[model samples]
Target chain A: MNRYVKLVNFELGRFMKVYIALIGITIISQLAAVIVVSKSYLNNANQAMNVDHMAIETFIEQYGRMSFNDVTNSIFFIGPIALCIVTLLIYSLFIWYRDWFGKNTFIYRLLMLPTARLNVYLAKASAIFLFVLGLVGLQILLLPLERMILQWMVPIDLRWDLSINEMIRNFDRLGIMLPYSIAEFAIHYGIGFMAVIVLFTIIMFERCYRLKGILLGIGYGALALIVFFLPVFVQEFMLYNYFYPEELFMLMLVTGLLVTAGSIWMSNHLLTRKIRV
Target chain B: MIEVKDITKKFGRKQVLRGVTFTAAKGEITCLIGINGVGKTTILNAIMALTPINSGQILIDGAKINKKSYEKITFIPDAITMLPQMTIGQSMQFMQDFYESWNQERATELLGFFKLKPEEKISSLSKGNTAKVNLLLGLALDVDYLLMDEPFSGIDIFSREQIAEVFTSHLVEDRGVIITTHEINDIEHLIDQVILLDDGIVVKAFNSEEIRENEGKSVVDVMREVYQQ
Candidate 1:
């Protein structure tokens, strides 16, 4: 096997325990959310018929609907999703810091490996990508499972059935997460992965310089962010009459590639030159 | 031979190494002796390119150090560099994965020599055992040069004696070895050359036999003369 592939697998193994926990939490919570929402709708109907002394037809008329929105809006459903996002964000930083600040200094061993030092950076970035993809894929798979649970709990007439696409379009966060078309999906995730690469670069800068590098790293990150969005800002203000949508996308694509390449180059340099142990 | 030419390093405003220069030849043990905070470890780190030097060059066999040159040299740092979560066997496997020079038979033999179990977790090992494991990792590699930073620092006397024994054994026979220590009582007889460092400067560097024959001074006597002054 290639060394880079081995390194990526090694990096993945390091984060596997927490990644599995995140998946387990998301699955359990989403299922519980579907059941809880269903029971609430049933309980409301029963209360209206028995406690309020209303007729069955009237009770059905008052509270006779359960929708995907009902389940999605619940705390149980949103909580796990939010947790996964927050956990992944924190983990991105932890992944780098842990090698330096862990009980034993693992950075020494990593930096001294017999391969190009950049493999460490690439391996770590790949692990982060894999983790994000794993979560996004899990959430996509879970939607249908949650839908099935909803169907099983509520009667056919009381449920507002919707396909996975419809459910995604209806939710703001889900829409952003699972884009409608393959092109949109690629654009969104490609930009997201680029952002991750840039973040990893900044983290490397901090690792190399220690206390003094923190501000420098933040400045570098800010600069990269501004450069990435420069085309959009220019199109809005300066180039409003000049470029078409395709042209603007081309500009964005070129800028994204430049930033990604620059970040990877800088990361490799820091890993080789300035990193302290 | 490994040559370090006029290396200078500073952390913040504090200069740690100032124009430090030295060489370690094949089949010789070069001992860098200094009090604490005298750039002994920094020199070893610089040689291995473990840490960056502000200014200088380190050459191995007349060529600049690079990824491939690392195949010819190995550094065993004082601290346990292996992942604390991994067992000794796993750490060995990790080394075997990355290093072409890793010898599994030698590693297995060293494990027995050190009396360390393959299944022992690095975090769970005693301080002496952890140091032994660090030493074993470097010694088991088929490299021409070995750099060790304070290998005997803070270990038990028995463990130190065990480590001292490895120096005399065939495990270290044909390699150029650079070792740093403030505590040098145990391995005094094992060193071929002694470099005395004081305040980030090499006050004296001489072959052990040359100093003994010329001045009739033991390493300890010279250390007292340099440090006491």
Candidate 2:
């Protein structure tokens, strides 16, 4: 196939092991979490009604029904999701560093490839993006299955059922992960894509420069952050309620495009011109 | 042909290559001989554009180095270029995937020549075998020019001998080679030209046979006189 695709495949292959492990962990842990939380709720109900000799009505009155919120808040549920996110963040940085700082100098081979050096950068960015989307998709597919398990363990009266959409709308993290509509999806993932691009650029800065580049990288990151949020600041303070919400979104989209283009250009320059093997 | 003109490179405050200049013509082996840490590897790196040069220019076949020029030249680094987890076969596949000029036939031949198993992981190979795999990767590429950084730096006696044998074999025929090494004794007779580097400067660059014939002294003899003086 094409060099870009090949590079992407190579990059994906590089991180496939860790990515699979993260997926396995998420599935196993979340399922176990649902089971544990459901059982715990049942046990509490049993103790109050049977052991304490309290009426079932009194127990029902005292303890509210177990809801989607309680199921999600359990360590087994949110804990694995949080773990996956944190691990992916660490892997994002590790992906860049492994080529250079790892035992073998794999960057030499990558840089020497006959393709335009930017393919390497884009390939890496694409791999990270692919991984993020894969995990999100997995979480999305898991919700209905999780709901089925909740229904199986907790009785109808004692459990509060919520559809996936309602759950996402209620929970902030889920909402971010799974946006309500197309426009919101685009906005949310657009921001995520930009963040990845900017992060890769900052990594390029550090890779090209070394100890001194760390400060330059951090400074560059702060500059990018300012540029990205500039339209918001303008709308709020400088414009004094001049633009509508849609207008602000258009400005932000334009800003995001400009920053992404700039990031790609700068990353290419560093990869081709300044980066040392 | 590969021509490096007045290339200068620096790492932070320290100057690694200072106005370095040299050339390696096609069908010739140019040996860049120097002591350790004298920017021998840096010069090779600059020629291949693996690392940036602060000033000066590098040209391959009378044109500046670029993505297209890379197709004509290959670098076999002193250190392992493939990931430690990758098998020799996987590494070859990786090379074959990116490079249009990659010759699987040559790679297979070298794999047999070096007696390296294709399925062996890079990390499992001995230093000498790893060096052989590195050489195999470079030699397999059907490129006009090859830049090798210390192919014989720290290998066992047998692997070094195997690598040295490839210089005379048909595997490297008609390919321009620029090799950097502080230990010159290994490939002394194999080299066509010698470039002596001292403190990032090209102290001397001359035909190896010419120096031996006209000056009636070995490269080591000349090195002693130049370095001691």
lDDT of 1 by residue, A67-98 (tens): 89888889999999899889888988998889
lDDT of each: 0.89, 0.88
- Write one digit per residue (lDDT tens) for candidate 2, span A1-277: 8999999998999889988999999999989988989999999988987899878778778898887788777778888889888987888898888898867989898889998999988998889889999999999999999889989999987888998898777777788889989898888888988998899989989888877778888998888888888899997889888988888889889989888899989999998888888
Q: Identify the runs in model 2 with alpha carbons over 4 angstroms from their true place.
A: A52-57
Quote the lDDT for A69 in model 2: 81
Evaluate model 2: give its TM-score. 0.97
For model 1, the local distance difference test gives: 0.89
Best by DockQ: 2
lDDT string, candidate 2, B1-229, tens digits: 7888998888778898899998899999999988898998888888877788989998899998898877899899988899999999999998898888999998998999899999999999999999999889889889999889989888899988999999998877898999988888888899999999998889998887998889898988989988899
Poorest 10 consecutive residues by lDDT, candidate 1 chain B? B63-72
RMSD of 2: 1.3
Candidate 1 structure quality by residue, lDDT tens digits, B1-229: 9998889999889999988888889999999998889889888888877789999898999987788877789889889889999999999998898889999999999999888999999999999999998988888889999999888888899999999999999999999999998887888889998999887778899998888899998989999998998
